[model samples]
Target: MTRRTENLAGRALMAAFCLAVLVPFAGIVLAALHPPGSVVPGLSWPQHPTLESFTRAWSDAGFGGLLRNSAVIALGVVPLALVCASLAGYAFATMTFRGRKVLFGFLMLGLALPYEAAVVPLYYDLRAIGLTDTPLALILALTGLFMPFGAFWMREQFLALPKEMTEAASIDGAGSWTVLWRVLLPCSRPALITLGLLYFLWAWNQFLLSLILIQNPAGRTAPAGLGFFVGAHNIDVPLLSAATLIVIGPVVAVYLFFQRHFIAGMLAGAVKG
Candidate 1:
């Protein structure tokens, strides 16, 4: 086959893959729109579709408080993670220092270790410090947990930059901090935004950490709160579906808004790193 034919075939396959993924989600939307307590076949559009299920789910599930708590955690995590990760990543990628490789190896070890494996020890440690059940605990724990990936991502972005750029900036009397903030970071927008959005989604949807770390129901994230909501309303499909959408809406919206940047960042990181 010609190269043109092969390219067309690849595009067709990708379209089919996207359709396969979206069909199930479309069904969930339809399920949420169906009348409460009514059985609807898979992917069937409801004759009397209404958004009443959304309202009911939002109010009944205490999603207002849950959402607030999630927002707090995400807001705390994203900026802190971004700043720390970018700095660390830039150091690892650009600077030569004693024990740099050893330190980076330790950071990479975090990527290998499952967060679940350390949860028990973390619990006891936090309990000892009297940090249990506080938003601070969640923020600190998640920031640590997300550090490995965030640092690695920013490191890759920095590595992809031309060495001459930094050299020229230095010759022009710009310090490392000035070069990073004024020169490199402005150009690293795609990677930065991608990292921030990923952190937001992970922090928002965090279930086990939210469930175990926060003793108060109001401090739980949406996914963790949805676990409790499911226990009581699992049989109510419409309500469950609506709650799922509510829990996922912000993540989906953020992804849609940054779709192009996210794709570009991922591809750039993969190719250049």
Candidate 2:
């Protein structure tokens, strides 16, 4: 097709794609505010909207504790994952040693082994280590679970760097660690931020691991706590919806603020790979 025709088609396709993605979120927002009886009565716009549901979801449902737990888990997971990914990525990209391919292949395998398979082993391991029902346990598990993808993605970014840059730094008598921190990382901001954001979203949404590891309500993350909010005794649909939206609010805000950065980083990493 001609360039103009291709451009027109692409724009049309993207507009449709945007509508497809946004319509569901709009529905959720509407439902969050609609009257209590309206969820199944029929879809309609919210009128005489009130945030009482949001307030109750925040306070009465004990969502505050869950929110705090999620924040702590994410805070801990992000830093630890960044450290592990950075080191592993630099090693895979720049350092050459025996069994390097074999080791990296093992790491790649982690990406495929679904965590459900490991939950039993992890539970036993946590029990053995006396970490069950603890925020630390959740943080540790999340860090380990995400490491493989984080390292793999970061390795692509590091490898895409021109070797000439590192070589020049070395010629100036800089050590490998120094060169990596000072020269390579400054150029890889997009990759680091992209990975951080992805890791945050994953840790935030993880319910299975949290559900299995955290039996205590105080330690439960937001998603699992939402499950508790909808119970046989009381199913407050509007409040639940409001709480769910609040749980996802931060990630959505981050995406909106960094949409361009996110797209650029993801495309650059993919193209380089």
Best by TM-score: 1
Writing each residue's lDDT as its tens digit, candidate 1 over 76-195 gives: 999999998999999998899999999998998999988999888888999999998999999999999999998888888988989899999999999989989998999899899889
lDDT per residue for candidate 2 within 1-273, as digits (tens), equals 999999999999999999998887776677678655444233567667767667767886687778888888988899999989999999999999999999999999999988899998999999898999998999999999998998898888988988899999999999989988999988888888888888888999998999999999878898888877776215656766787898898778877887887888888787876
- Models, CA RMSD each: 1.4, 1.8
lDDT on C-alpha atoms for all candidate structures: 0.90, 0.85
- In candidate 1, where is summed lDDT lowest over 10 consecutive residues? 34-43
Cα distance off (Å), candidate 1, residue 43? 1.6
State every prediction's TM-score relative to the real structure.
0.95, 0.93
lDDT of 2 at 262: 81
